[model samples]
Target: MTGRRVAALAAAFVSVAASAGLAIVAPAAAAPGCEVDYAVPSQWQNGFTAAVSVTNLGERVDGWRLTWTWPSGQQVTQAWNATVTSSGAEATASNAGYNAVIEPNAKVSFGFNGSWSGTNTAPRSFALNGVTCTGEPGPSPTTTTTTTTTTTTTGNPVPGDAMAQVEAMQPGWNLGNTLDSTGSDETSWSNPRVTEALLDNVKAQGFKSIRIPITWGQHQGSDHVIEAAYLNRVKEVVGWALADGFQVMINIHHDSWQWISAMPSNRTGVLTRYNAIWTQLATAFRDSPGRLVFESVNEPQFTGSSGDAQNAQLLHELNASFRDIVRRSGGNNASRLLVLPTLHTSSEQARLDELATSIRGFNDPNLVATFHYYGYWPFSVNVAGGTRYDATAQKDLTDSFDRVYNTFVARGVPVVLGEYGLLGFDRHTGTIEQGEKLKFFEHLGYYARTKKITTMLWDNGQHLGRTSFQWSDPELAAQIRSSWSTRSGTASTDQVFSARSGAVSAKTITLNTNGTTFSGLRQGTTELVRGSDYTVSGDQLTLTAPAMTRLSGSRAYGTNAVLTAHFSAGVPWRINLVTHDTPVLASATGTTSSFSIPTTFRGDLLATMEAKYADGSNAGPHNWTSFKEFDRAFAPNYTTGATTLTPEFFAEVNDNARVTLTFHYWSGATVTYHVTRSGSSVSGSP
Candidate 1:
């Protein structure tokens, strides 16, 4: 995802030596005839994305090469959809794998991201297959043939449950490189102009959502007021997408100048600008249907000399401010679904905690959590087809989703997958090929459907053609559509229970799930009554005294207990716990732990630790002990002698489950040193 700019030709002169009075030239026969559409779709001041399409009007060709020269010394830095080579001002592009063949009257295209100084212009002449094209070159074409058939918006009822709505929003597409371009014009980034026909094409292909990442900072004035013209343009594009029956998401994107991490020196101004931007957007879209969503920020994070604690505190405050501003903006804005991004939109466990903690206690049920997934970065982003699309890659994808589900979805919160995609690197062809792209899409689609997470694919004028109004790879497009329909049964409801004091006592309990009737819920074989038993509201189902008494046998599960397992001597073969029967929670491998059990499984659990060696012999699950029996300690700084660091070392062995150690020293005059632990050695910082 780079920026784009419109391509302009640098004027050049074609000359010949004046040897003879008159130079006689014979008219050529039916040589190769072609037309070229060279465009720079996105650009920054120094870089741009260049896209070219060549149509063969003459005989068929199995392979083709295009050669052009840059007068402004623009260098091709990276390319996709073709193999490109540059030497000085001249550049040549060869056909990649799937696009090698060009039938009569058919077209082939490729693109590249390039850097420039002075001026950026398209080559004056393009020689396709060594025969110069006949089409005149200036700016690229502005329109595509629209389909006669159009589908109107259904104005579907907005589901009260955010997660349910997210599930309904299946496969999605991004209008990337166009609006999100760092350059001036929307088309500066090499993508063709956005048209009604394009929106129609996307909806016709079964995409349920359109994510428009727009950079608004560049269009604002010194007073921070967005330009009227720019707002109108955004409205026009948004209207097109919504008219074509697509859910649309718009956000403030790529504003690096104003985006700073949690630092007191810069935070106040950042929040002010954020409020200004969202207030305008919210007011404008207030009358639009509920399908229109406002994302607070693309990826919010701190920059320069900021610690994790400070950034975390700032992110929390920023998210709360975003929520308050939109709500106060009035109109439909009060109830409009808002998306809050985690730290850097990351899916890491600790980052998830940071996001959840920051936004906790908000009463707005319409708010949906969001994060970008580029799990196993190398495998998912800018990757070769060969390295990805394997079993390992599949595991990485699933594991990432599982973490998201456990972190947010398992609770009452809903999550939107704002961004996820394969970088589409085809090695042999130097263009996007089928196999890996299809597999990645399938995994994305299947995960979205099963996990009930909304997904949007990132496109940068490659996989799908913005000009042709057709998929560059038809099979890949079909795979995405097919995977969208591949889903399992309805997701199971996660219950929130309550505990009472006495046997057969009466107390109300709430079920934290999207609505179902009182009779719909049962404890073992007993059916509960409506008003006499429980009441329902959104995802909360509250049970009455009689119903609670009847359901007394069920333990109310709340409060998540964390399991911290530390390996010092050697890693275990496997970690196990027995309640109903022995179940292996995780297989140990590394020097640390990556396993956690739900807090609901809190009472009377037994840990059966086991280890296996390289020789294939297994150790015993010999340690059978109560989790509660483990010692929990707390101590303040105490000095034993003069001029010694206080509380030098502390260690705790929780049965055979985990071991934790810490060292502390007094900040002031008190100094002491000591170590507590036996039969095991340890080393590390305080």
Candidate 2:
């Protein structure tokens, strides 16, 4: 996720009529009119964050001043995107220099964090430039009212059965980071514009659907009018997918965070903008085939709301409004599949239940429920020692799927795992080992299949090289494609280790047969006799000591030989025959801003690093966990034979405090090192 600045507000007070030529002096027939939306998105025990949006409805203004009185005594602590000052229960917010000019019917918004006591009731009335706001738009010459009338067109009719249609959309793919890029244009994010060849390749790759996420805010003007060129361009891409016989889903992507997130405080303005965007979209695609799906808002979440209850209600309003607008647009949209997501697209039981209630209330058979899964929280980002697809990680996956399935699928509601992949994969693949990632995908595919839920792979140009139209890791891709229909045989560990300096011993691996019959093992083209080289008893496969020694010829460091374990069905399992000994670390000294420990890997691979204080408390970044996040707090450079402690790690550590560093290797070896920070200088010892 990209870092977002914490919005703040500066203290300022300006008289509404003080500015020369900026006074609220309008003709008798055309007095200034405005709309104000006050929202409280986040609230804690005694403090909360509130957002205010003011729309100049009657006349254009070069400078603006808005005043409101809080029902309860609330003190503004901080704010952003505007200047805010308070006296007693009265608050005054004026536009900042950059956003001072508000065109007629255009909105400017600001937010602030404040402390409150007793009842924190929102102010019922607001005044902009000394004129009371009506909380509704006033007539403006630039306002263009669009009226949609039913028109017949030649195209495939929408399918009546939404379940069947969604079923056909199995194994979907997202055209991510392109249109959804929060930049000036689709190519602004560096991903090439949508091409027919791209859709062709996606269809050829066995994906039945493509989720083209489009951000409309960047291309929208006053009254949230989408640029026709951009709209036609989006239609062209959707047409390409539809022409290729692929089910297409287009959505309001980053706009959810851009403006829709302010719905709680700016309900009227947000809804007005949201409705306009959808009305235009629905009207444009009204004649298209039912294969086109409309997701109300991508991961609808609100700020300036009291809590989850308010957030849920806000989402329901948006979803309901979207459904109503689309249905009223006529044509095939009346029966088109409308997809809705839970708050933040979460698969939690409570969120699922909330969505379920809304679905039942809608009682629309053409609606589908959706959520996103990026594996478990820890394993998703390779944090808190979640470097492997262990039981905890696996359980998190299964448990999440089970909840969504039971809540939606079991009740005759089709579910779409809108996006699925490791969260760390977004940073770049290889954060998790190749084998662990493959296992995670394989399990997810099989489980989603069994649960009868369609899954969409979220690719932001990382998994698949968009230019080459090829997967970066073909082996992992093969595992994923194979899991769609059948289960694959996996092992307890993909690696078998042998000491580089000692006599080799027999190594046993627990195989997850997954209903697949085990065949003989092979090294390159030579097949090994089962009894001589290996023995399989039930799920356990053991390699003979002689075979291990021969595989590790001369006991070389690192991987000596690669063996493939063949199965009767599904993809073959890869076993790396590695030879390694305990790793060694040496003391070093450097400034607190940068530090690295010289390491002798001795063929071992670094797994995770743990930092702790003498008092046994977690140290460094993400102090709640002893194991610091990989790639963020620390990173291993095997090529340089060194493990680096990132500056971010040093930023939070206490000065003059000795922190214990424990480096865990993949081969079950642990090496301890200690580092002490004194002002800008740091020193380490093994």
Candidate 3:
């Protein structure tokens, strides 16, 4: 996810361990009327950045002490706040200020930059204020360091050799009907359902890779367009893959025709949206480390794959477009390899010896060209009528793909087989019988590495042996078994933010298929919010925030706010509106959900729904993606005897000639409390 899509700000959160499958090895303990809850940055890799947070669990927690064990290989080189005293792998810290006593259930947070081996795990054990805390893993930590290399071509390549690198990460499995309805190519591609449970099964069996050939076009406009809703949902699934620490490959999938068709005639516009999509996704995962990648297009076809000339022409254009888009995104995306399409994007005689150079401007160091392998019709296909099975054909097919990689070695470009599968139009399960499939897969796995090529089997998950894809039989067991056993690449992971709908048409408030409203979510009762800058009218909410943020080319992450309902409570509701790393201010149990407010980023309330019937099951624990933060006040105006607002802290103030107000903290700290002349909380909370 890191790439040109990386955000200027870090991914934000208070306690993300639950969402991340992380356990706080030690839960905090406290005296009656006195409580303390602590947190680390949402990202806790084996890095140099050190951070810790302590919240008064009950009464005010004035002084604090924290202790924990660091992972063996990672050690702290520098630290701040309290002090770092370590022995072997254990460390402890004591707060310097007595007032640092976190007030009642109030919270105080701190951090220091550090480094690690790029894995997601946290420090274990902790003693708060000299008292042994209970949780094993203390808290979620923030991420440190971002990989930002942006070279598009290779550093060292054998001249005249051609290379392609497919982002082959999905495990090999037959697809189902839900994926492909037309019985067309879209059918059962890596059915997440079947493959979801079978991933470990396939990996254990020896399958090295799986290609989730998703046909997103079905969800797009008739013109083969992509909708934000569909994209977000896809991201959710991708998130699951990443969390599993699996090597995942996400591309335009089968919507090549629609997606490529939308590519701007000018590389700028196309690159703009290209970076936009990746940026949104990347920013969400910037802090989490992983081996996931974005493949530009499934199979680009500017011109049909009629012959070599057309194939060459299409590849040239795709190469140019792919490079242009990669360099614009930042973070890991800067240097992460991007897979480009071959001329016809398909393997056919018409595409013999066809390839294109790495496009310029994409010199981010990690770019790979790609082509598919299938050869001619009947020979390439597993038709029920095609004589019997052909093991030799399968081997040759694998060799054909190897040829594409050979091309890369000659051209010095990293290349991969974007796709390779066999099927006949005749019988549903006719093409490439299960036995032939086994041979095909065996040859593929054997030759893949030498060819220096990565691959994705057209393992559409749902249908399987029911149709053209026949991986269900005993003969194909090894294919499935091997795939179940042997995995490729690295499977590191980090959490990613997911906005229900990435983009919404301006002025829309339905929260229907297009609009993704933040509702049906809260720790206790729920409240409503409007859009980014709209006001709430009855049940309708609208937002009023600015379109752009201080961050360049990046708009604010959360666009909805509390427009309608508010929470009372059994459990405190966690909220997150800003997509970047979250900052912990103060958290308490007694306060109502309505009492929580916001800062910089804003959200709109659509409608808040809460069902607190005794019979109703509590959401138990949850996280809020709302954009809310408490407002901090400034120093008093000297001569005017009035607190002055600097342009830095200026509010539009609606030109009321500026009515004055005081700033206040919920714990009633000596801090001045204030209400706007408009009767709004200083933090802008209603």
**TM-scores, all models, native as reference:** 0.47, 0.77, 0.38
Ranking of candidates on lDDT, top first: 2, 1, 3
Preferred candidate (lDDT higher): 1 or 2? 2
**Quality of model 3 by C-alpha lDDT:** 0.38
Highest lDDT among the candidates is held by which one?
A: 2
For candidate 1, give the lDDT: 0.55
- Stronger candidate by lDDT (1 vs 3): 1
Residues 438-467 of candidate 1 have per-residue lDDT tens digits of: 556656777766776888877777767776
Tell me the lDDT of model 2 at 246. 90
Which number leads on TM-score? 2
- Candidate 2 residue-wise lDDT, 315-355, digit = tens: 88999999999999999999999999988787754467567
Write down the worst ten-residue block by lDDT for model 1: 5-14
Residue range with the least summed lDDT across 10 consecutive positions in model 2:
5-14
Model 2 CA lDDT for position 134: 90
